[model samples]
Target: MITNQAIEELVAKECERYELERSGFIADRQAAIRELVAQTGILPESCSLIEFAEWKERLLNDWYTRRRFAGFFHRKSEKRCMFRMVKRLLQNAVFRLRKKQTELTLDDELKMEEGRTVAFKLSSAFFEGFYKKTCCNGTLFVSPGHLETVCIDELSLLFPLKYPLLYARLTAKDNEFWEEIWRLIRRFVRFLVVDMGGKEDTEMIQEVSMETVLSVQEQMERGKLEQITSARHLLNSLQMTGRNKFREWLRTESRKREEILLSEEDWGKVEQAKEDRREVDTCGANRRFDYLLDIDEKDEYEVCCALVDVLSYGSGKVYGELVEGREKLARAMLLLYVENKPYEEVVRILYNTSDTSKLVNLRKSVSRGKEYLKKRMADLIKLYKRKGEVPFATE
Candidate 1:
């Protein structure tokens, strides 16, 4: 029987010729596949579906194959794919995750199976080379590619597929000085300040206490405008009027009352509040929020800012090296295969396979590589509890 991989490739390949010369996304996908195949070339001349499947079976054997592809459709909470939204901004957070590099395909039958698995034996030297050559102090990730015998020092860097949307909300109206962080607000505009280390300068609002933040909401609520029913009206309200001077002066006096400066623990409380305002699903508890920050906590800021920028900007000597490492990851697609011998073969030689009994060693190597990468990814995330701090932290 034809494997799912074969079916997909065949369908895409055949469909490309009939449709294409059309304009739009469908045409773009066809062109992308054609280009990839042209650049990477087709499978080995004799790599037929049955022979490949048979080779896969031998490589995994009954013991391992049963676990990896089996029960793939089980109601395992994390494994099952789900949909989430972020209103007017980008929807669907590209799930940054890691999984085993497997050649076998999964569909109806394979999804229904249960618990067949395989493992690989990786060399310690390879691990060291993988991290050192590919990363810079947990900031950058090396490019991904397999079946290459090259050292990490000889890797290429890869960038994110797209730049994440980041914007600092401008609280002050008619302010020409605060022009730098004006992002295209596809969603509702929200203004709040963050204190990674300093107070707001460009476009960022000055950090205020949690009590003041809550008090602002309460004041709006007493006026029967808790909904912030109109964006323009809220902005106008924020501007001081002649009659509003008295209340504004009162705020200034009360602000002096807060001048004692909160204790460190109390400060941590604000940090935690800021985090919660983002509505991030940390620790698995869902708390409700009705204020401006809670409703429009910018998701794009955290991941792209804290993670991607720091990795590139902070890596003194390793920046170029990380780029090379990431190039390997960009080339991977469903049907691509790397045939290479062990350490003796040159890394650039795509079709070099070691003198082995069969495909068993290749699968084992993939299994080992998957586990090693997954563990390292987890370790790197501990440095930053927030997803915005690191690009691949979500993985």
Candidate 2:
């Protein structure tokens, strides 16, 4: 079993290893920057802003080229060294053959030559930016404080890589521990990103340092990590809620703008409209002669089931014509209304979707079914009346 102490020790060791690697990287980067400044003969204070920008772009291009080439030789384990060596040899051979066959232009030859020497170049935009930001009066001078800032930025990128090592180590002993830790790290990173939008790497890394990891470990030991995670989720939810409320407020304002307040004459028109509706209602009341007998719920279900059976089995040409190849609709209605299944269940049984958003579509299907039944109810009543076999009790 991986105890909390064991986990903490492992984290501390990994963090120490990361710090060493980060320090070395920063030292190397600073040295490279100094070399490039000396070799290029472009003093930062002497150059115009445009020239400085172009120089930085060139440095970035060189860094990207070197990084890409180094990535080719990066191995996860020492066991793969022989394999990579063989692969590299084969690639070199293929490249030589291709070079011999093709007529290389001056540009192509220069590019190839640059590729060969890219490993020796020490131009990294990351470090260049760091140098500019941390230097005193734009001078190419390295200090411990500048190196620390750069190290923090590099650690932000390095922390994610270290988690997989923790994951692998904990898999045999305590998988849940690794998972919980991973969840906290992921949530913390997301919260940082959202809370500090478009901030520089160093600024973001200030929140994601080794101290933060140790704090998380302490929180996990005390069983408070879950509460912390829940708080973060609540914060995110509140942000979304605030945004939604703002949208709702904007919509309300828009609607208020579109609305026209009524004058006294408009009020009189509203009263006149009420009177017209009452007159229509009175006429409708007087014209209705046919009465529908009330049935209990059980009887209603039986009658509906019988009607569905008639429609489904194509009992008559009229029934078949009314159904019109809407068997799926009929089934959906039966499951949704008659069976009293929830929309999600009906969707799973019908459209195979449990997604809440898709439940609206199921509701729409049930609504269409209701409308179909209402529209065809008159036809069914007429058919039953003509045959003198109406299912319901009549007046």
Give the winner by lDDT.
2
lDDT of candidate model 2 versus the reference: 0.40
Q: Give the TM-score comparing model 1 with the true structure, all chains together.
A: 0.18
Query: What Cα-based lDDT does every candidate model obtain?
Result: 0.29, 0.40
Where in model 1 is the C-alpha error above 4 Å?
1-212, 220-223, 226-228, 240-395
What TM-score, over all chains together, does every model reach? 0.18, 0.26
For 282-360, candidate 2 gives per-residue lDDT tens digits of 3344211122122222343334433443343333444455566676776776665445576668879886767643554
True lDDT of residue 90, candidate 2:
32
lDDT of 1 by residue, 219-285 (tens): 5446544444333443344332211432443465465355322345544554565465446456543
Candidate 2's TM-score: 0.26
